[model samples]
Target: MTLSAQLGIIVGYLVLALLIGLSAYRLTDRTAADFYLASRTLGTVVLLSTTFATLLSAFTFFAGPNIAYHEGPEWILVMGLMDGIIFAILWYVIGYKQWLLGQQYDYVTLGEMLGDRFGSGLLRGLIAAVSLLWLFPYVMLQQVGAGTALETLTDGAIPYWAGAGLITAFMILYVVLAGMRGIAWTDTLQGAFMLVVTWVAMLWLLTAIGGPTSATAALETEAAAHVALGSDHYTPQWMLSRALVIGFGVAMFPQVNQRFFAAGSRTVLKRSFALWPILCVLLFVPSFMIGAWAHGLDVTVPADGNVLPIVLTEFTPGWFAALVIAGAMAAMMSSSDSMLLSGSSYFTRDLYRPLAEFSSRDVSERREDLLARVGVVVFATAAFLVSLVNPATLFELGDAAFSGFAQLALPVLAALYWRRTTRAGIGAGILLSQTFYLLSHFTTVVPGTYAGWTAGVVGMALGLGATVGVSLVTTPAAAERRALYFDGNETGAE
Candidate 1:
């Protein structure tokens, strides 16, 4: 595509997103609940689309292909098929219960629900802190992807810093203006666009480069190792551990977790999960093929592994390439907006509320909304600045983010299901799990094989053990509190 055409396509997509945000703002109620959770009023289509789009971040759009380009089709088994089922199952298990509690208590954030459940402000703060630690990197992944994609597509016409700043600016504007409602509206549109464009681009590329059969034959003869697993790098243990980490981590992402409350009804949530795997199949199969085909074609992969832009520019027509780039931009923005909104909500509702002098009841909803908008600016700016450093490839940064969040999976499950779970037990589990993950991640204390097992999985095992052992020794939460979450019966005291 000509530089002007590609830039125009991308700018048009952003304008559409901005318009959606403005429309949603007109419809918004301007209350904290409405801003954060869309006033619990998302139907099946928007609910499913927003959740699916949010999950399919820049990592999925860009990094999936990049990994498949280098690591072979095993990336499909690890994230595409396995994570599809894993995240779907978690949505059913965790999301259902969370929706029930959120509806009953009118809770806006996970921290509020957990803190009230355990009657501990410290636990709430810990959850918020840990979520941000992981979420920040994930947001940065989107910024990095945006910058790299723009730079590659435009051939240095647009600088990396400007590209990152552009995305960050749009993200802050839309999120601060329309909140979750705007995000959901834009995500639904962007998700459908991305799915369609991806399939189209894949088909076009496959046809132009012979066919899938030809591509497969080429891969078999030239890049045979890319078709199979069990290589030195993709060990069985490594694949399994990586899958587990992404599965668990994705389920508990703050942006994702809050979607549980946004569902209009149980049926909406259930229908979304039912359709999730099918959507995964459609989106990922083509992505893997495109990457693998590029390898067979002997395309000179860039330093950052941005093979999609290179492939499109070389093989496709100008219009088609522009459309594909716009689709990719949509994917990044959709994920970025949700992350910005969720991160701000965590900071405002979870972190700030507890530390503030005023009672939550005394605080006005308007002020809470304003604080969250301020947080949107603050968090998005930080992520944008980090993206300028080019810390790592999209896949590497995402791996770290997912691993950190996965450590919370066991503790969350214990708190939700096990009546014996105590405040101290949950607290200790989070601390120890995060500490172990950091140690294993940054240092050589954990061996290669164990590190391949992923710091999150190892930490989760230890954390789960600590949670169970400590809870066994400590007092359980009072029956009244337990009944509130488990038995659906409140004692009026809590």
Candidate 2:
């Protein structure tokens, strides 16, 4: 495959994506539901595809392979396998309930639901602000992955900044123009392409090395530490622990919550949850192979993270390579658009709207809409800028944010089921927990804060304690407390 031909195919795929977005524009453009939740009419197929697409992003495609290439097979084969199943089980247990509530409340975003549940303006704003802050680093990591892939695939013909700019421009136009419908519809197409290309790439690489048996043998000899399970630093316990974090944390991701809200109904959402683990197997396993294969073939590069793209370009023919590049871009764009929309929704519903005292008819409502649209551009631009300056792996930044949110999992669960949990306690606990988690992340001076998830656990523990203890000490407000906790009417108990 010549470079020109590869570029041509890539452009053709982009055009197809744009057409899908344009076609879905009318479906998503009309009202609040249409814009934010795809009119609450998404079926099972669309929900499944969009869910998988949202999960399989730059980190999964590029970074997972890179981890396998560098660390060993345990990181992907063992750890990743556990992650898929665990995530599915967690979703089955709690996710359906959230979906049911979302339908009952006509919820458009996670912050909206949380605000209603807590019955506090300040807590909602805090949660929204924290979500936005954490999301920026996650988005920045995605932009970095995409820019690196484009630059390396095109051999620096497109610089990192230029690559970031191109993707951001396309996403902004795609997301703002059609909203959730455009994002989901385009994701359906991209997710399909990426899955097909992944299998093709795997088969091609296997064939390139003669057969699976021979390839395994070759990898065992050449990259013994990386190819074999439990080799090097790959222990079963460590792998299982890592998998737990990844699996559980995925649910706590704000982007995934937004996806849950995007579904039309509980049935569609439940089906998507059940199917996502299988989708994870399809996308994540092959990426692991790409890494191990790259290692066996001795295809070393300056940046280990580029191993996936480098392998795609090396093992596959020109046209196939072009398709692979397009698939990678698809992954990047799918996740990016979801994050942009999720972050913007936080700005609109949680911060701006609440400050207006939940009134949709206020003068500030129009300004808030404008602010959200503007936020889409500003957030995307910040991501691009951060990627250009310091390139970090998507997986690392994602895990950091994941761990941060996982701390809130306890509080969220408590808030949902425990009526005795007071707003003051919930608010104070989150503040303490998140603060401890950050201090643990940034500074090593404090002992016992070194365990990454441990920080979240401790923080959440203290926060929960404070919430329960404080509520016991102080009397709950008669009107608001009863309305919020007793009747299960976070949306005014109608």
Candidate 3:
């Protein structure tokens, strides 16, 4: 297809997304809860599809395939097979607990839940701050993915920054028009769209190469190392640590965690997680296979680009290929819009509300509402600037962010289930584990691994140890605040 035709398809998709997102403006009420959690009323289909779309992002569409392209299909084990199951189990373990307590307490954000549990606003502020800090890269990654996909597909006529900035602007407007409701509704469309495109693209590529049998035969000759199951890059430690990082880390995402509060019922929540693994398998396998096929075809991808678009354009016809790449852009938009909306809630609920109360300032719901919208704009713009810098590859950037978020998982789990958990214990765990994890980023002198454990494993281990050991020695914050999470209003909730 001509560049104009491709741009038309891409631009038309972007406008459709914005229009769909904005259509929710009338349905959304003018309250913080409505804006943040869609008034806590997401049913199974919307919840399942939105969560599935929100979690995959540019990371899954681009980095996932890129890994299989360069390394091998063994990268499949890194994601769908392990991560899908692990994350689904966590949704039940952690999410169900949050939903149960959230009903009684009406908690809006994770930081609020944890802080109220431990009776420490300081911890709440710290948690919100850390979440925003890590969320920057993950948010920026969507822009990176969009930039790469469009730039590659259009042969740079769109330019990397143009694609990055276009998605940024679209997301900011979408979040402002409607918050959780808009994002979730649009996510259902995008989720289904991306899945169909991915599978069709994969099947088309396979058939174009003369069926799966012939494609496998070609791969064996051209990429012998990638054809087999094992890759030296995937050590047991790497696999285990990665699973933990993605499973626990993703649950802590402001976007995904916020979804916990949005579930209409325990059944909706349970069914969503139950279907999560099936969704993962449907998307991950085909996307990875498409990338592995690139090696068999001798496709040359740029250093910054991946195999998905390059291969799609090569194998599929002009209009179909354009739609496939646009579908990938939908993945970026679906994820980015959700992140901006959720990240804004973190700032307004956890930080700004508390600050206003502390200052003895009379703030209206209108003021908080405005602050939330402002938060969306600020996060979207900041992430766009970072995308221009192109600081790192999608995989590296996502992995670093995941590891940092995973540091919080252990402490969060302990606080929710362990009545013995104390303010000082979770506080120590958060500060110490995150402190060590951040140090490893700045200084290589801090060993990235010890005794076959990856840096993420070491960080989470520190958090778990500090939480359990310190809680054993410390006094509980209060029994009254802990009862909400305990069964039968037990006095031992302390």
TM-score of every prediction relative to native: 0.95, 0.90, 0.97
TM-score-better candidate, 1 vs 3? 3
lDDT of 1 at 158: 96
Candidate 1 local lDDT, residue 150: 85
- Model 2: per-residue lDDT, tens digit, 1-494? 56778778877787789888888886545566777778777788887787778877777777778777776555556434644687676565546656766777877776677677766677778888878877787787777777888888888887888777878887787777768888889888888888898898999988887877887777888866665457536655455545655665666666777666666667776676667667777777777877876676757667534788888777778688768878888778888888888788888888877776656557455676677789999889977887788645666676677667766666666666676666776776678777877777678744443233345445556667766677667665433343443344455322
Cα lDDT tens digits for candidate 1, 349-412: 7888777734545556667777888888888898888888887889888988898989988988
Residue pair clashes in candidate 1: none
**lDDT of candidate 1 vs native?**
0.83
Better of 2 and 3 by TM-score: 3
**Pick by lDDT: 1 or 2, better one:** 1
Predictions in order: lDDT: 0.83, 0.72, 0.85
Q: Show the lowest summed lDDT stretch of 10 residues, model 2.
A: 485-494
